[model samples]
Target: MKRNIAVVWGGYSSEIVVSAKSMAGICSFLDEEKYNIYKIRITKEKWTVEVGGYVYTVDKNDFSYICPISDQRIYFDFAYIIIHGTPGEDGRLQGYFDMLGIPYSTCGMMASALTMNKFICNNFLKNFGIRVADSLYLNKDTKYNLRGIEEKLKFPLFVKPNTGGSSFATTKVKAVDQLQQAIDAAFGETPDVIIESFISGREVTCGCYKTKDKEVVFPITEVVTPNEFFDYEAKYEGQVEEITPARISGEMTDEIQRLTRKVYDLVGAKGLIRVDFIISDNQPFLLEVNTVPGMTQTSFIPQQIAAAGLDIKEVLTEIIENEFNAI
Candidate 1:
């Protein structure tokens, strides 16, 4: 029997366009014979499902995907959420799906919510012996004091939104004068922000997945962006070069993979995830873990999957199957 799989994308996030692109990639790669795929677009006002190459707009109040032929409603057997940020990655939509009793690919509500906040997530992992960069959390309600920051951390610090992705509001400030401006920009994007000591090191990431009884980690990917940092343009505009199986020592590679799996288990994550890190002073520091990673043509997960000599579609199918059987 062919199960109905709903590939959900496009949410109220700054990464909405990126999410749509990822949804396209996922729909194209999903197996056609084993499952009946439905491309569902989640907008602010309505939820529409594409079936038989035609789009049918459904009410957002009701969770049913209306069948045009039978005039009956069909619920999704499983949902593959490709939305990258905001409601999708921040556990809002995941909680809604949980209430609906639907199985979706990705971590549960708590893990997703915790990992979405960079400050809280990194601090939580520190108890498990994870090395994160030295950072100070601040919010709009807090007092702005540059002298304290200057005393605690050196120049060339990174200012970023604590809850956003795609490097949307990330800036590197070299001097004290630029600190306030950077914070303003970051705060414009999110209420909470963090300022961290910038480390001059190679940026690398690793992808991981878990099945019913086993976990598999993919090769590390080294990211080289043309800009000062891996910001929005570098991430989405092809202003960067990504190398799979990062050109690093064998020992470093093994250590990163080990840390990746450890953090995955630490956060109690399931399905697919991408762990970002930086190698500084011959040591790896945990940056963040993405629960809903992008699946675009240039996305890191697909590249790593290709490097591992595995079909992307097959891997996604296995992930969905695992989610189905886990229930």
Candidate 2:
């Protein structure tokens, strides 16, 4: 029997369109023989599932939708969530799926909620001896204290929302003059903001996957954005240059892989995850881990998978198959 897999995408997040695009890429490459695919769009009120040339818009409140085939209701064997930010990445949708007793890819509620907040997540991991950049958290309630923050971290700081992806409101401030403007831009994205000491080094990302037996780490990829920094446009606008198997020494590669596995285990992540890092002075500093990394063709995960000489379809299929065994 072909297992029903719901590729859930589109949410009330800023990355809705990007999520939809990722779903399209995933659906296109998924093997048709092993599983039945459903491109499900998650809106405020309904869960629209599309499969086998038919569409069913189901009321999420009641879990009722028009059956494509017979009158019987359809339940998915697994939900492959592709939503990048907001509710999807923030654990709301994961909790909903948990209530429905459905298996989904990525971290659970606690980890998702924790990691979604960049400042909190980094600090939490720092307790594990992970070296994260020095950061200060800002919110609407707090007064703007630039001098205090500057005392702790020097100029050329990175300011971004506490919870967002694709660098939606990320800014790199070179001096004190740009501090307020950077804070305002980050605040525009979310009520919470994070200002961190900038590390001048290569930007690298490593992808990790958990199988039934062992954890696998893909090659690290260095990101070179045309922009001064890897901002929102550089991420989604096809202007950044990414090099797989980053031109680092074998020792650096091994160290990064070890750190990636450590972080994955620390966060209790399952299925697929991507960990971002900054390499400075021959040391890899932990940046953040992405539980639900983008699955588009241009995404870093796909590039790493290809660089590892594995087929993307096979990797994704393995992830779905391992969902039941993942803790």
Best by lDDT: 1
For residues 179-290, what per-residue lDDT tens digits would candidate 1 score against the true structure? 9989999898889998999888999999999897777899999999879999888888889999998999999999999999999999989889999999999999998999
Query: Over the stretch 1-327, how does candidate 2's per-residue lDDT look in tens digits?
Result: 898788889877677878987898888778889988888888776678776677778657534456845877876878888888878888998998888888887788888898889999999989988889999999999886788778888987899989988788788888888899889988888889999998889899999998887667999999898698888788888788899989889999999999999988888887789999999999889888899898887889889999999998988888888876653
Q: Against the unseen true structure, what C-alpha lDDT does each candidate score?
A: 0.89, 0.85
Indicate the residue-level lDDT of 213 in model 2. 70
TM-score of 2: 0.94
What stretches of model 2 exceed 4 Å from their correct place?
51-55, 61-64, 325-327
Clashes of 2: 0
Clashes found in each candidate (C-alpha, N, C closer than 3 A): 0, 0
